[model samples]
Target chain A: MSTIEKNVPGTRELADLVREQEEELAHLRARLAEWERTYDATPQRDALFSTSSGAEVRPLYTELDREGSDPGNDLSLPGEFPFTRGPYPTMYRTRLWTMRQFAGFATAEETNERYKYLLAHGQTGLSVAFDFPTLMGYDADHARSLGEVGVCGVAISSLDDMERLFVGIPLDQVSVSMTINGPAIILFCFYVAAAERQGISAEVLRGTVQNDILKEYQAQHAWVFPPEPALRCIIDMFEWCSENTPNYNPISISGYHIREAGSTAVQELAFTLRNGFEYVERGIARGLDVDSFAPRLSFFFDIHNDFFEEIAKLRAARRIWARRMRDVYGAKKPESWRLRTHAQTAGVSLTAQQAENNIVRVAYQAMAAALGGTQSLHTNSMDETLALPTEKAVRIALRTQQVLAFESGVTNTIDPLAGSYYVESLTDLLEREALDMFDEIDALGGVVPAIEQGWFQGEIAASAMRQQREIESGGRVVVGVNHFMEGSEKIEIDRLKIDESVERLQVARMAELRASRDSARVDQTLAALRHASSGAQNLVPAILDCARASCTLYEIRHAMEEVFGSYKEPVFF
Target chain B: MSESIRKIRVLVAKPGLDGHDRGAKVIAAAFRDAGFEVIYTGLHQTPEMIVSAAVQEDVDVVAMSVLSGAHLTLFPRVKALLDDAGADHVLLTGGGIISEDDMAALDEQGIGKLFGPGTPTTAAIDYIREWFSTHEAV
Candidate 1:
């Protein structure tokens, strides 16, 4: 219901400017008509000249495209209101974007080694990728976890595993980002307990947890509790973290998975910002101050193949979020209006054939992310389409960012595309489209309702189907997939394989931890957590108590599930 | 008089905790568009649920996508359950982030052709049709 007409010139000034440009515009139109007549006579190559999202692109963009908009309002300076240029005035000039590669596979010890290796190789921050069992709040020994333990990411079933995962690493010096949603609270508590064991207090902890569950229903499909209870847990984290972990972001509202799930750039922008707004509303409903929690709220987006569109998406995201926060939500703090984001190059855009070509694709996407003013980025590796990236591939992905930061000289200027006619016009167009979509979502009674009715899923699936058809029917040209001739080319990149014994090792470790931990304390703390889950109290303290008692991830989740129950997605394609 | 032909019924099931269902849903839509009956089992279906759905739906093929690197454990389990349930004729095939060597190994174990990333939907459609033409009695 929020309007995007916040800062506009007076009607009289607009009328006068239009009057001045009227005669020139008429002349320009006549010339454009004559040029079009000649242009139509000349036949060009037959192809689709549109963005990956199916938005039509005109052959040329000029001042006519940005005719009536006030440049001062639309293209604001960096560090100003509606930050379309960049979030900060000195974006990369002061500090480069963090090259945080999302890495984990097999046991905690193995992943711990990998983390140390990445840190030694100049990776600026740590992003954890937990295995399926850990992400779903299942123990390594659970029957549902058979064959999946530590396969996709690191398997941390207990505080012991979490402690081992961060062994030898100083918690105070390194910032960690955990990509967990379903059991984000449990993992977060374990992280705090692990830091406490290292003699570090929660006040100094700095990191982010991908605790977004709305997008889980819409795109990612990872959830433990139903929408209402899942939201309660997220709000509880917001309340607790605002008081305790001042430096840590409790939730990273994400559009990366949404874009990866086959949404258009505009859909990704609209859905993600709407989800962030829903969280802000929920946090306010919980009686928290907007500035207290909104400043800590961060964003994650996907940098896809369309370079200008991706950049425009980021610019539009910041402008829309800033306006909504200040104008609609009444957030007075400037920090609340700043939309800081972490971006990752699109993994869905990678090809399995001619995998090395992915390196080139990632380089361009990384550059786009850099130009888009991301605070941090994770570039996809070439071999990622086939399996988990090998060590060398991950290093190269990191080096891609390094080269962009240093060799590419893109960081020399902030918002280098700020005044370009095409970028500014596209940014405005994307913002308008997002506003329209927001109205559509508003008609559907908000994000959670739309998700329950499968509206978001349906839209994403339709776009995905359209893209697939385009690829198959030769409407789109993917270098090695449908267009290029690379018959009988063998993939030669080294693929990382998870050792099967890692699961056995984790299961045994879980058993040993269960046997050695004090059963009385564990049961007492878990009972307290279960009791607190049904009440309106902040659940973090109780969860942290359970973590300190050596309770496992599934144990904490089951305690909540006893009251919240599980979520079964509505079955649809 | 012309004889009527039964449509190829396929169940597109996602068999593990990995929630990357883009491929499964895309393939399901492709199959539906290609004039085949696709029963999408949605996300997080265990091997048992997949086999039961395939049996209950009476599908000609049970295509399960396992992208969580659990293919070695899941594909074989589903295939064995299909065989044990006296439905061995159902083709157990799907696609994911499976490597070529693993695909060969799964093929050796009687799993059908598995597709990887960036594969055209027509390839799977043609494969399923050719599979049905040879394996089923028209």
Candidate 2:
């Protein structure tokens, strides 16, 4: 203190300045208190003033609210450590987020034509939506796949279907994101084999397979094997892709389904980030460097109706992930610290009543995703609540992203709302809440154990029940649902009906594939897969051989099931 | 004669490969809170399994949630199975991403009233109570 006083000429001045500022701050606090009293005295609407996550929103937010937050450290510049502002320096200034519409239905050939249509209409990337049978690791002709073939998404059972899915589309030129879990590894092998058939090597391929399995057990419920074996397969992909396909993201640690399955925003952010960290820990446990696979690890989040909260969740996600990677996991690479994310507008928020309003909801959510620094975005179609989106509806959904990227001035700057006191406070709150949840999860012996104990599912179901109750009890207002009543308003929007013959066609195709392909090769590859499943060898290569031999999705799953066993969820309400 | 009123037993199930169970679970919980005995069959339930569970549980209502657009097939199949199992009196009612046209189509096939998105859990609860009161010996 003596040395500082001696060296600094304005020491006394500094003290005086601090005192004056303190007095001024006191006066401002007094005035603010008076203002709050006045505001409180005024009549207000009898509604819950809170975010969708039930976080209370005050009438005003100022510097007083951001008291303990160290702005410079908490929010460094974009592309810096603890990347709260954005992941990259010039986020949308250099290039806009990829407009990837998740589209698939009926047969492979039909979906291929739709992909071409989407591409021609200015879509940036291809996001494949597999049908239920394919997603559940069943062949189209399987008895379980009877009426479900091509009902939800495209049915891709073999490498032939995967090849037909991208007939003329160049794999090297297009980035494909496949939304398949449960049998994600097998489908990924089928995709790799399909690319190889097109003469595209694994090294040159770039895309993401939504190989997230933890969320399946926790929320989505599309699980094949138990947690241990499913995680082993995931770690196998992480190791295999680290060397074979460095550019491809082997897993998309998704909170989209978690939120869609009815979790709050903070829960989605925390659970998704926790799942990502679990993958990291697993990869490291498998003896791979954190920087090796962590860099390629990507995230998928759901953008709900709470605009500011959704944006804040993304910001907090980046910050928490960055700090965890660098400080917790002790990663050395900047890429390892960066949390790249793809966001989709919430499908649960859409309503069948006044379906057109969903377009606006999706548009706002898209803006939130853009403002939140998403690397990619998928906006939900208005007609999605009723059925699969029609072509026109999907086009409009894509156009929403286009308008946000082009017309919306939000892209003109990186993290335009970074310094906003409200956003910063919300981000801090979400981060703190998520950190607390992480501790609770740790107390439960981590993600897998927590899922096994049904903690995650219970939390999600409880939150979902609360939100449903809020909507029903008029605590929350869902337009055209609980509040606005358009009596006798018939839904006139054009609906897309999938022909039942699509199922029969897929069945016949599966039968034809069985009769034509080398039966001996299929049997041999499947046998090898089964054998490899029992060993410590990476299962990707074995699965790839099966895909090349035209083994059906179920055959590969069945072979692994012999060793891995199956996951039957603990049924509860 | 003092007669004991039978509590409406409901078997809430998810049919086909649809994994979305928020609706099913919510409805199940709501039915329970509304004083009904609820039995939930978790995800990936086949029609045969659902009907067998309904018959085994001897539930008055077999509410199935099918969001995979497999409702057109799943509902009719479950209904026919229940009929074959001699449990045709059980109500086949549930909700999902179902359209009015499809709802009407299913209703014509003797399926109970189907709910849609944004439908209050109370609507289903009240509908079931009304149906049970009218159909069952009260």
DockQ of each: 0.85, 0.87
Q: What TM value does model 1 have?
A: 0.96
Q: What is the TM-score of chain B alone in each candidate?
A: 0.95, 0.95
Docking class of 1: high
Candidate 2 docking quality: incorrect, acceptable, medium or high: high
lDDT tens digits, residue span B18-128, model 2: 899999999999999999999999999999999999989999999989899999999999999999999988889999888999999999999999998888999999999
Which candidate has the top score in DockQ? 2
For each candidate in turn, the interface RMSD (Å) is: 0.8, 0.7
lDDT minimum window of 10 residues, candidate 2 chain A: A1-10
Please provide, for model 1 over A472-543, each residue's C-alpha lDDT reduced to its tens digit, 9 standing for 90 to 100: 899888898887746526888898998889988988988898999999999999999989998989999999
Measured on C-alpha atoms, candidate 1 has an lDDT of 0.92
| Model 2 lDDT at residue A14 | 88
Determine the backbone clash count of candidate 1: 0
Worst 10 residues of 1 chain A by lDDT: A1-10
* C-alpha DockQ for predicted model 1: 0.85
